[model samples]
Target: MDLQAVVDSLPRYGEPLLTTIVVTVASAAFALVVAFALGLMTSSKHLAIRTPARAFVEFIRGSSAVVQLFWFAFAMPVLLGIQFDYLIAAGIIALGLNYGAYSSEVVRGAIAAVPKGQLEAATALNLTPLQKMRLVVLPQAWPEMIPSLCAFAIMLLKASALVSIIGVMDITALAGLIGSQAGQDRLVHYSVVLVMYFILAWLIWTGMRALERKAKRGLGVDVKPVKGRLAPEVAAGGVR
Candidate 1:
């Protein structure tokens, strides 16, 4: 690969990279909030409250995210007679709904993983249902939910690339533009964008790993330290 050629190709992609990052971060935050709300609603004891939330989650999960994106971009305005920026609306609706469904499952699993004994103990203490969830269950569940949440966030980030289909000019779109401009150097141009995405994904993974370690520590879970082993002489000295 001609390294200089790839370097030269990067400027054309800068805007697209920025657009992708912004959409990913914004959409993931929105999705997290939506997921938490809907997930809780789905777990509600009242059939009226739970049924719709459960159905929504199931429907979103069963559908194709790309198809949803296309619907939002093309069909929504016609159906509702309201216009929105294609990229912004797509980011908000597609990612928020798609990841929200996945997050509902994560939340449900986390809540289920909370031991029945804990709920009983809370009830024995005369705690309200809300109190039990707030004080006893969610604290435990949030940490457990982190790994899954991180995975969902990564998926959302990659899926944000699909916004390019509607001419959103996200990272993938920028790569396509660079490929067109570079002609025979298309391979080098696209390679740079690929490497950039790989690096971004790696950084996200590393950050999530650090967050998981911190959460484990906060929860008083034993995390084995990576360090030098204690010598037998030192152990004997301490025992003495």
Candidate 2:
């Protein structure tokens, strides 16, 4: 193996790894939308709303993500006779649907955790159910939801690696290619993949922390840093 060739090939992986980040972020955005919609629906008092939301969440949650990814990427386009970008559509939908189902419970729990008195206050103010959720409940529930959503975002980043299995040339896929070229340097090539993953995950965590702080702002809570990261408890309701 030419040492110079190995060093030079590393930079080539950068673009592919960046795709991993883009896919994760896009998937998370899609998933969050699904989560909030299903979560709120599941929490609805009416059976008409709650039953379908519960069914959607349960079906997605119970299904295997690997199979889902393959189905959307490989089988769906063929089965449905629809043309689409297999890599993008499949990764986004699979990640969104799978994690969206898992995180819906988190969103539901956070919204439900809002003080009952606040709900009463909204009712007294003659606010519509939609207005109540938009203006009052969500504002309070958002802070509590941040930490859990951040965790799910990190999980999404890791799960995005699975895209390689479906022929998406993400970081892991690049690493496989790099290993093939580098011969006995497979250890080094894959080790770099580990570092890439850690850095991506850490970036996700840091961005979420910033969003967490912003979410806390409405509560007038000042977050104290702990071990170089703000404590979620402080951001939640620890203000004096």
Candidate 3:
């Protein structure tokens, strides 16, 4: 808990932490793209598109991510007769697919929250489906979606800890290594790891809160000025 000890500990885990951040960011980006496409498909008018997309999302969400990671890391190579580095393949396949399903729900919800009036207006404008979605719907939907997306990103970051199970050497794995090195002080080392994890989670939460506030203000929902003006409107209306 001494400042110097914490600093020294960080250096030992620095490389693994960097790897964890890189993998999480890359996989989450891929997941976001996949989720957007699949979620759109799930909401498609065509049963042909929607059913399969729904099925895929359900399958990914229902199964254990740890099992999926193992399958991708081990069974995939044997099945395809291709070798992949453990960390790279696990990060790409498992984290990407798992988060993709969750992000799909976020996408679906955001799309649904787009006002029906806007859709009707788009129709009146004679916009094609794609044009309406791209120009009108998505632009509006994105702001509503930002908070959920940030939450999903943070969840994905925590989930990346599971990649260490498949030999990826993420933060959790590095923590385990450090704990082992500390021997009888394993409990202390792991306590430090817990603190690190808590700090990381807190940072993510704080960042998301800031984003939520920014989005609210950008959407004209921040109430400070509105509250100040309310008394005058009430007095003018003779309600007070």
Candidate 4:
């Protein structure tokens, strides 16, 4: 195999790889904001608030992300009468909205799973609704939600690949470009690209693990299961 050729060709793709990372990171951050906002909105006492939140979550989840990306890139500019740098915005919004729909459930589930006694205690303490959520409920739920959020972040990273189709020149795009110019076969180019993806994924996994441990530092002496696919444990520092 022309391994040396593949290795030598990699440096040229660095900028696009960075583009891919930027898209994924930016999307993940935006998705977290959307997920938490919509998730909490679902719990509102008023139907007006809850219904729309539920509808939006379901609507975004039900739709195809690729189609959404296309729309953001191709259709939104015309419909909204606003121009866009679709190359960037399309990937970010489409990935964020799509995954945010799924991750919202994680946020909701974590909040819902908090024991009833905790809520009652807050009520007994005369905590305001905002105060209770901010200080009492969320503190307990945050650890549980981290694993799921990280899972979505990983999924978002993979999904960001679609952005390349809209001319983002990300991994697949750069790989193909380099392969063509260097006269390398698919086996050589794609194999190298796959390794690059794994490296990025590993870095994210390790960082998330560290954050998980730090988040649980004050939970308690006993370990509690973090929800989602990761299934890690955090000590019950205090919240339980």
Query: What total of clashing residue pairs does each candidate reach?
Result: 0, 0, 0, 7
RMSD of 4: 5.8
Q: Estimate the TM-score of every prediction.
A: 0.87, 0.90, 0.84, 0.89
Residue 54 in candidate 3 has what lDDT? 95
Instruction: Report the C-alpha displacement of residue 103, candidate 2, in angstroms.
Output: 1.0
Q: List the residue pairs that clash in candidate 4.
A: 218-237, 219-236, 219-237, 219-238, 220-236, 220-237, 220-238
**Residue pairs with clashing backbones, model 3:** none
Residue-wise C-alpha lDDT for candidate 3, range 1-240, written one tens digit per residue = 354554577777777777767777788789989889988998788999999999999999999988888888887789987567655666677889988988898888888889999999999999999999998877767767777777788888788888888777877887777666533345666676677667776777787678767766766766245554566557689664
By TM-score, rank the candidates, best first.
2, 4, 1, 3
Candidate 4 residue-wise lDDT, 1-240, digit = tens: 476777687788878888989999999999999999998998778999999999999999998998898888888888996667556877898899999889999998999999999999999999999999999899899989988888788888888889988888898888777777644776678887888888888888888877777778767623445456342333434344
The weakest ten consecutive residues by lDDT in model 4 span 229-238
In model 3, the Cα lDDT at residue 240 comes to 47
Which structure among the candidates has the greatest TM-score? Answer: 2
Instruction: Return model 1's CA RMSD, one decimal.
Output: 3.8
Kindly give the stretch of ten consecutive residues in candidate 2 with the minimal lDDT sum: 222-231
lDDT string, candidate 2, 1-240, tens digits: 666667877888878887888889899999999999999999999999999999989999888999999888878878996656557777888999999999999999999999999999999999999999999999999989989998999899989999888888998888877788634377777888899889888988898889889889768976754477656777687976
lDDT by residue for model 1 (18-105), tens: 8878887888888888888887998888999999999888889899888888788888779986567555666567888889888988
Best by lDDT: 2
lDDT of 2 at 177: 78
